[model samples]
Target: MRVLGVDPGLTRCGVGVVEGVAGRPLTMVGVGVVRTPADAELGHRLVEIERGIERWLDEYRPERLAVERVFSQHNVRTVMGTAQASAVAMLCAARRGIPVALHTPSEVKAAVTGSGRADKAQVGAMVTRLLRLDAPPKPADAADALALAICHIWRAPAQNRLQQAVAAHRTLKGRTA
Candidate 1:
């Protein structure tokens, strides 16, 4: 399955696209960042995010979208903007009738690097090694985005199994008297 992963930040939103089924080294469809002026108004930032995500949807045409969940820390303002970007990304995916999954930054790190508390450099290094790249994906945010996609790929099977079981149960119920 093709997956688009997003790391939402108001100033710089990271996006990565990977395509493949479970347990596979997916092809790198794309990787980049959408930058908006930190001085821009919140409305402007949201617009930028909406447009960026829309473009990604058009370009990647991914089957599923994965995003990093908002983590509230000391920077209340940053958190709010990140949340706004996240909302915009999710909305874009929903409008296209695509499935969206939220993975925490820690979860993404753990899934990719074997440690939830791993640092950005560590995550970047692991991503480089896992994807067999000569260099780590530039800009920590982009690497984080790639890690998010990888996490979703690893997690997709249990979700698919659960979905299949639910569908089977629904079909059985419908056929019953």
Candidate 2:
């Protein structure tokens, strides 16, 4: 499956595309950052994010979009920008009828590095090795976006099975009732 991963930020939103299934070597289709000037107005920043995300969706046409879930931070201003950028990504995917998956930062770190508390350097190192790249993707954000895609690719199979099992149980219960 081809998945696009987004690490949303106000100034530099990371974007990456990966294609492969679980238990196989994945290919990095593309990786980049969607940068907006910090000095830009709030509305303008959001619009820039939207345009960047839309262009990615149009080009990659990923089957699924994996976005980093916004979490509460001490810096309310920072968190607000992240949430806004994330919303723009979701909106772009929704408009294209692409399925969107939200993964927490910890979840992504654990999936890629075997530790939820792994540092950015460790995550980048693991991502580099996993993707067979000679060097880690530049700017921690870019590497992070690739990591998110890798995490989703590795976890999607189990998640699908769990969903199917829940549905089956519900159907069986309904029949008995």
Among all candidates shown, the one with the greatest TM-score? 2
Q: Per-residue lDDT of 23-46 in model 2, one digit per residue for the tens?
A: 999999999999999998999999
How does model 2 score by TM-score?
0.95
Q: What is the TM-score of each candidate against the true structure?
A: 0.90, 0.95
Instruction: Give lDDT: candidate 1, residue 163.
Output: 90
Instruction: State the weakest 10-residue window (summed lDDT) of model 1.
Output: 19-28
lDDT agreement with native, every candidate: 0.90, 0.94
The residue-level lDDT of candidate 1 at 8 comes to: 94
Q: Give all candidate RMSDs, comma-separated.
A: 2.3, 1.3
Runs in model 2 lying further than 4 Å from the true structure: 172-177
Q: What is residue 167's positional error in candidate 2, in angstroms?
A: 2.6
lDDT of 1 at 106: 85
Residue 51 CA displacement from its true place in model 1, Å: 0.9
For candidate 1, write residues 73-177 as lDDT tens digits. Answer: 999998998898999999999999999999998899899889999999999998888777789898989988888998899889987898999999999999993
